[model samples]
Target: MTQAQQLREAILAAPLETSNFGETPQPGTLYLPLSHLKALRLDAHVVVGGRGVGKSFWTAALQSEPLRRLLGLAASELKGMEVHAGFSIAEHIDNYPNADVFDAFLAEGGDPYDLWRAVVLRWIARQAGKIIPHDSWPHTVAWLKQNPEDVARLMQQPRNWKGLILFDALDRTSADWRRMDSIVQGLLRTTLWLKAYPGLYAKVFLRDDQAERTVFNFTDASKLTATKAELKWARHDLHGLLWQRLINAPDTHGEILRDICRSTQQENVWHVAPEMKSESDPQRKAFETLAGPWMGRDKRRGVPYTWSVSHLSDGRGQTSPRSFLAAIRQAAEDSLERYPSHEYALHYESIKRGIQKASEIRVQEMAEDYPWVPKTLAVLSGMNVPMDFDIVREKWENAPAGALEGNPTRLPAQHIDRGWDGVREDLQRLGLLETKKDGRIDMPDLYRVGFGLGRKGGVKPKG
Candidate 1:
């Protein structure tokens, strides 16, 4: 076996992990894209992004002291700063209430605003070595509502306690759109309430849809909105993240990848250079060594460097590090099995297969986020896209009504009653589909291949 084969095996074996729901990402897994710098600062109160874009990843990362120190490399304010989660992916009943508690609290005619303030009052009390109500969520909330003076004293009780409180996975707050909106709005209002105290801050990680709603309807909400940051990944950022994981691969694979990347060992882990973090010649040249220049026989076939990221993009033209890395790992496996003697670690054809794998994963994510998505998209699975909306509408109309049935708790199409146009709008908002310039509907390969849709001269869905 040659070094290229070894590289293929190495790439095949790379951990390449993405969001593990709520697990703390390894220190070596830290690759702070320059774009995310503002999102991690102690001051940014509201961070928004679509799925697979590091919303949860950052939530878990900021919880670890070591990871926070690593993040301090980009944002100096994070070093040694205390951190806590008001709400997160992980369940910590002692720290905050879970979805069921929230549902029950609201079901009993509780205002979300009072419930959230109760959550903060408890955190402040615990830090100050003072006891507050904790028998149940409603119990604490009752204490908060009943004793305004004590709550005020606890909130203002001057202490050296200074830190950032994070709230994430807000979708779990409630399944119903209206209630979820109120709950999120309540949290934001609570965050705004926290703004009065110096040195105490709250950061809320919200989904794009959640952030776009009436959650910011409260007075002084602009204070949080003004500091809002978006989590995004550029074409180069995805490649940069891939090499970060590859260079830090264990043992010999790590050494091999580090050599290709010219990575130097730093802080007990391989550090990707500044050049690799951007769309510079060094970054482009590095990927070419693994994937080769052209995606096909020659230049006329298109450049592999640009083609891979472009094809994996969502309807909004965003390429997430999660999807990009998953596709690359699958690509390496395909290249090894099908083209063992190929000049590069990733063959053009194998790259195509990787898209399908990533698409399937993305599709699963969409279904989980919106259970109605799969059935809705399934109505047009066998058809080609970039077609007229009328044609797509006709297909959905003829389908069984049960096809659109959704889980009782999960949200359905925003305009389910408004008909196909509403469903189309929902899909577009979710990055599943887009309207072309000419009003023809199109689906990005990220979703298209997974939904089993065909495209003219485009990557095909798995047979």
Candidate 2:
């Protein structure tokens, strides 16, 4: 059979959970059953990370398995339990009246606190299991005016329903810092309001950088820290995922898959070694090569490599099994298409090419939309200095004198209101930039490796 057919058959034999990745499952995504909700009760948790780091997939997985297991009911069961799950409505306010009211509250503008009050009351009334009189808007407003204290008192009452409200895809919202901040604040407040109700829960998924910038306020660290879930992939966990997929492939395909894993590891190590010393040495060298150059070395000059052949290539340290599986599947498919005869060796090359292609697509697509995109990417691509807002702005402002002016480039900062902020947001969204704890930003190793950039210290200046 053709290599693609063989690989497909192998994947088919694997368990559904074993072979899928990211938010939407495909043939090779890894299913990690992380039961984190067991530690949380009566409060919301924020799951945040870079794209393809498995935030949404983890959220979906959490909601799919442990959520149902913990709550003892499916989504349908909670459908009538006075819950609402959706993305932020800040972007849609002008079009949707109900959304407009929430948007106004988020913006913290308007003298009509009563208008805001009426909106909340109506929303509560519309929630599942809520029984409010079907009065006109004016009538509802009139009633609230007279019973303001009563309405406030009712809101204070502890909710006793069992339901969860999930809000995802916040990253897709417009890149307006003020609007983004307001939305997160409004959501947090909404979560607090829901928390007062014993039976209600709210969950939001966001990127780690976005969450740091928008959600985690120093003044409210207690509130923010109390409800945070960070997504991270351990090396062993990633390895388990790869093994699971290989095992799931159909028998013959499974053998080939296993052989590929073994051969890739062996060849990668052997290709790098000056001389073979021991079996463990080959495994170590193989992992180091797969991990790329961005990984840190110890003070004593020892390299620390976490991923194995079974692990995903996380040049940026943000990849999850989903991204890994997606890359692998795409590589395999591309190989099948290009070199129909030499599927074996071609598939390996396809994996490497697929990674490079994915990174290029991310950069190119951003460049196509934002004028400054190419400059931003070029600045990132030609990394002679550490990257941050100031450096980016300096480079952008002085582009006429720099090497990039003659290139086909557009500056996104020129078109967007907050150009620097916009470029940073775009880069972060595309997984090219990551925020460190000290507020510094850096590229993921995957991007650096795919672009042929050297890692820290070991890298030399190139012309």
Candidate 3:
């Protein structure tokens, strides 16, 4: 077989799926970006990121002793530290409260600060093989509030170990914005209080919107805010991640890829290292070997390496590594099926189809995190972006307001309470929509393609 045939077969077999990272990340497959190092610090209390940006990935990684030790190579602070989950998407009723328990606690006029303290006390009790009120939240809160000195004494008891408590999927604690904010605020207050005792720390993973809300209303919220880090991906970071996955492909593909992109051996694991200062240069060349230099037949259509990422960016100019990888995977699959005899493994048209696939995946994720967004956006399908704001409002007005049909009524849709203007602002904040310089509203291709919106000259779905 020719080299093109081998590359095509290899591309078809490359392991490019990112959905598992959102669920339970495989430690062996993780690509720790340089920017994420700050987030791994023990002192970095708050980790803010958009959906699919490795919040859950880190939450799982930190829980595993072996993984944490491996990660310590990148961030030396993690070595020898004890880690525990304060709360996670995977339910652990004994360790933390769920949505029902939180609602009951609030309904009884319980203080969030005191309630969170009770959670910490439970962990302490478990360590000492002692029992506290586990049957009732109110009883637990009463015990914690009534015996502050006892709690302090228990926490102060010297231990030979240092521990880090991680909290992710806090969104599962409550659906209501106000209630979730209160619970998070209380948790943050408790995290701050934990600092009084050495060797104990709290690391929270929060959505970008959740971090910007009223969770910091109380005094000294800045203590945690000051050390906050966002899980952002740069252009190079995204390309870097692509190569990291590429080199790990099955033997037929991996051997050829290992030659083109150089790697370093550390702890017997092969890590793809940057070959040039630009970083983009090596990444571009690696991709060119598969898709060629231009997106189409010539340069006017743009370079595949740059065009793929730029087009996938959200309204805020952030591109998710999830979407980037998904598009490339889809592009390769499409090329193998539709353009089998082409010179390149990935065709320009196939790349456009890949964006469509990524947009669809993004929409599904948005529905899971912000259910009401689809309720509002589905009405605007086929509408061109950068249109007058008033025109956009009229579309929403005509659209059905079934925002609460399947969601909890108490938990408002991310910003549905603020009306159309509020929803628009929230969308822009989440990078789903943008306000162009001329005051018209525009949708990024990432969201636009999936939501069925169109631009004068843009990729359209296969129907």
- Mark the regions of model 3 whose C-alpha exceeds 4 Å error after superposition: 20-24, 135-138, 276-278, 400-406, 409-411
Q: After superposition, how far is residue 219 of candidate 2 from its true place, in Å?
A: 6.7
Clashing pairs in 3: 176-411
lDDT (C-alpha) at residue 247 in model 1 = 90
Task: Please give the ranking of all candidate structures by TM-score, highest first, separated by commas.
Answer: 1, 3, 2
> Residue-wise lDDT of candidate 2 within 272-294, one digit each (tens)?
11122123444444333333232
Error of 2 at 190 (Å): 2.2
TM-score of each: 0.98, 0.58, 0.94
- Superposed by TM-score, candidate 3 places the C-alpha of residue 61 at a distance from the truth, in angstroms, of 1.0
Could you tell me which residue pairs clash in candidate 1?
Answer: none
Regions of candidate 2 where Cα sits further than 4 Å from its true position? 2-5, 8-30, 33-44, 58-83, 86-128, 131-160, 172-174, 214-221, 242-316, 337-347, 361-375, 379-395, 400-445, 448-463
Per-residue accuracy of model 1 over 1-463 as CA lDDT, tens digit each: 8777988987876779787577888877888888889998777899999888898888888878877766546757766567888998889998899889988888899999998988888888888889888988888998998998988888887877577889999888878988999999999999889988887888999999889878898888888899999998999898888998899888888888877886766668787888998999999999998999998899987888899999989888888888899999999999988999998999999998999999999999888888999998898988998889999989888998688687888876776777888889888887888998898999999999999999989999999
Model 3, C-alpha of 414: deviation from truth (Å)? 4.1
Q: How high is the CA lDDT of each candidate model?
A: 0.87, 0.47, 0.81
